[model samples]
Target: MIRVLLFADLQEKAGIREIEISAEKLTINGIREHIMELYPQLTAIKTAMPAVNEEYAEGEQVVKAGDIVAFIPPVSGG
Candidate 1:
């Protein structure tokens, strides 16, 4: 079970900040697709940077079965 932490409007839209997705079929792209499927309000998810184990990661980044995933939304505040 990979944990994904959401923020900003995403949490509200998805109704939870943290989620456990099956790592077997879980990819960064797959997560985004799931989010889109759950919340159609999110037209785009690219603005968010995916972080795994405390470092910025790519879409194709491989995640372990119990890794921690953070979906960090871009912040504009100074």
Candidate 2:
């Protein structure tokens, strides 16, 4: 299973900070889509940045089983 982490408003919207996906493999973009299906309330996820193993990942980055993925929502501050 792939572990998914949610942060900021994403976590609040989903009502959870972490999730485990049973898929053996999925692309970053696929992960985003899957999460959206699971939690339609998290609409901001479409623009969230994905990270794999603590490093930023591209949309096409492949995530394997046991990998840790985090979706960080956009933040604005001044």
Candidate 3:
């Protein structure tokens, strides 16, 4: 399973901080698409930054089973 974490607005919008996807492997973009499918309310996910195992990952980065993927939305404060 691939563990997915959502933060800030994404988390609030999805009403959950984590999600588990049963898949052997998927690209970061694939993960985003899956999350959107699971939680259509999280439309912002399309622009969220993806991190794998705590490091920023590209859209094509492969994520295997047991990998941790986190989607962080842009933040702004003044």
Candidate achieving the largest lDDT: 2
> Candidate 1, overall lDDT?
0.77
lDDT per residue, candidate 2, 1-78, as tens digits?
999999999999999999999999999999999999999999998899989999999999999999999999999999
The TM-score measured for candidate 3 stands at 0.96
Which segments of candidate 3 are over 4 A away from where they belong? Answer: none
- What are the lDDT scores of the predictions, listed in order? 0.77, 0.96, 0.95
Comparing 2 with 3 on lDDT, the higher-scoring candidate is 2
Model 3 — which ten-residue stretch has the worst lDDT? 32-41
Poorest 10 consecutive residues of model 1 by lDDT?
38-47
Q: Candidate 1, residues 1-76: lDDT per residue as tens digits?
A: 7888887867777778888876664678777777777678765466788888789988987777878888877778
What ranges in model 2 sit over 4 Å off?
none
Which ranking of candidates, highest lDDT first? 2, 3, 1
- What residue pairs are clashing in model 3? none
Error of 3 at 51 (Å): 0.4
User: For residues 1-78, could you state the per-residue lDDT of candidate 3 as single tens digits?
Assistant: 999999999999999999999999999999999988989999999889999999999999999999999999988899
